[model samples]
Target: MILKINDLSVRLGGSHILQGVAFDVAETGVTALLGRNGVGKTTTLRAVLGEVPATGEVLFDGRPALGRATHRLVRDGLGYVPEDRCVFAGLTVAENLRLAVRVPSPDFDLVFDLFPELRQRAGQRAGTLSGGQQQMVAIARVLLNPNRLLLVDEPTKGLAPAVVTAVAAVLERVATRVPILLVEQNLAVVRRLATDAVVLEAGRTAWRGRAADLLSDADATRSLLGVGTTAGRH
Candidate 1:
């Protein structure tokens, strides 16, 4: 395993946000962290990166990663792409990528391979790009940083279907190099990208198993995910 969370709990503003959330992520595949909104999916990612105060055993490569600063985590081969596409508006795409360039990893070309449009718009200011393009910049910037483990929170949020497909493809290619823990609400994207899943409900893990098993078992999906008539309805 590349990442492990055991008996992790986090409280924010006097409310318990993570109730003993636990999961494991391997080095060669994608693990989807699925849940409805306000169920601690984002909070869990933040807690893992030490962005929020929490008590947990977050082991990365068997070393303690909990309570470590975000920059330290980045330095130790962990990359985080937040739900909000946080590209520096004033900087050009190439500048943003250059800012994250680190040593000992010459995989910058691979990012271009995954996101070819970014290479074409390398000279454009990040803020001028469309939402989809900005997202690519945000993800690509981290790849330039040369991290091994990726924590991606909601890459498909608010994207058009075509754009979402493009981003998913990029993620799949990126997964070939590093493990991913993806927090996603889109069941279709989750089905396509995840090898395994951990379903969260009200800050606790509700179900843990292979994605295929969960998808095949409709009762498990409806029970654990609380899928009602509203789900997948147009």
Candidate 2:
């Protein structure tokens, strides 16, 4: 397993966000974390990364990961692309990527190859780019380094149909190199990339199985995700 979460729980301002959530990510391919709105899907990802105070066992490559600082965890090969696509508005695309280089030699070749538009707009400020282009910068920032696993949240949220397909293709290519723990609501994108699936409900894991199996069961998909198997762009 690339990552493991056992009995993970989180609380903020006296409100429990996650209650004993448990799941595992294989060392290869994509694992989709699915849930409806406000069900702690994003919180689960944050807790694993130590962004919030959490109590539980998070094992990265079978080693205890809790209690470590977020930066330390990131330095230890945990890459994250947040939902908001938090690019520095004032910085150019090239400068945004440069800031993410952790190792002596960043994988510029791979990043440029995956997102050629980023190279073309190297001098363009990230804020001026379209939402999809900004998302590309966010994903490319993490790809600049070598990571054992990636935690990507809502990569396709609010993206156009064409851009969503483009983003999914980039992720599919990236997954061939590193495993990803993805928190996504877009079932179509999920169908295209995810091999394993973990569904969360009200802050706890509700189901775990093959992605194909979950989607094929329309009843389970509707009950848990609040959407039919055909939901989202297809």
Q: Estimate each model's TM-score.
A: 0.94, 0.98
lDDT tens digits, residues 77-109, model 1?
Answer: 899999998889999998988887776675678
Model 1: clashing residue pairs? none
Stretches of candidate 1 exceeding 4 Å from the true structure: 104-106, 228-234
Span of 10 residues, lowest total lDDT, candidate 1: 225-234
Number of the predicted model whose TM-score against the real structure is largest: 2
Q: Relative to the true structure, how large is the alpha-carbon lDDT of every model?
A: 0.86, 0.94
Angstrom error of the Cα, residue 218, model 1: value is 1.6
Report the number of the highest-lDDT candidate: 2
